[model samples]
Target: MWTIMMILLISLLIALFEVPYLRKNAMKREMLVFFILLVVATGLGIAESLEANIPNPLDWITFVYKPFSDFILGTVE
Candidate 1:
């Protein structure tokens, strides 16, 4: 719970520090992208803190390539 709170607090601090520059410079697109990335990062951080089972990207790659690797080994043999 404290880890989740810390992640949110850090994200909030980042936004507080950055939002004004974006607003002052009229960077609407950048602001939109920033918020989107911040939300994604914060959600992932919270999920990790909660010990949620997030799938690794490499797992998917290994799954996809396992058959190809097996075929290559068979051909080499």
Candidate 2:
């Protein structure tokens, strides 16, 4: 899809512009972390563009706590 292509192109452009500087500076660990974050962010962007319902931490928290909240409210009432 065009969105995916655009994402990849942007990522590639960023790497092209940043990687040599990292390499020249010997920032191996920083580069590794940067690439990992970039891949994750790009994947999430693509998934969102595809209308995927990505589960968030808030969803898990609500699922775990909603029942407890209801029970406490019922007892108080």
Candidate 3:
């Protein structure tokens, strides 16, 4: 789809501009992190374009902490 193509093209453009500087400076770790973040962003963008129901990160945070919170509140009561 057009949205997917646009997402890829934008990511490619960002890499084109950034990758050479990273390579030229021998920044291996930064380059790796950059690629990882870029891939994650691109995948998220494509998923959004396709109208996928991406779960909010906060939901995971709340799920993880809810039990602890409940226990703490019970102790306080």
**lDDT by residue for model 3 (1-77), tens:** 99999999999999999998899995788999999999999999999999999999999999999999999999999
Identify the candidate with maximal lDDT. 3
Q: What is the lDDT of every predicted structure here?
A: 0.96, 0.91, 0.97
lDDT of 2 by residue, 6-66 (tens): 9889988998998998888856799999899989988998998898999898989999999
Candidate 2's C-alpha runs over 4 A off are: 57-77
Better of 2 and 3 by TM-score: 3
Winning candidate number (TM-score)? 3
Candidate RMSDs in Å, in order, are 2.0, 2.9, 1.4
- C-alpha RMSD between model 1 and the true structure: 2.0
Off by over 4 Å in 3: none
Error at 45, model 2, angstroms: 1.1
User: How does candidate 3 score on lDDT?
Assistant: 0.97
- lDDT per residue for candidate 1 within 1-77, as digits (tens), equals 89999999999999999999989996688999999999999999999999999999999999999999999999999
Give the higher-lDDT candidate: 2 or 3: 3
Local lDDT at 15 for model 2: 85
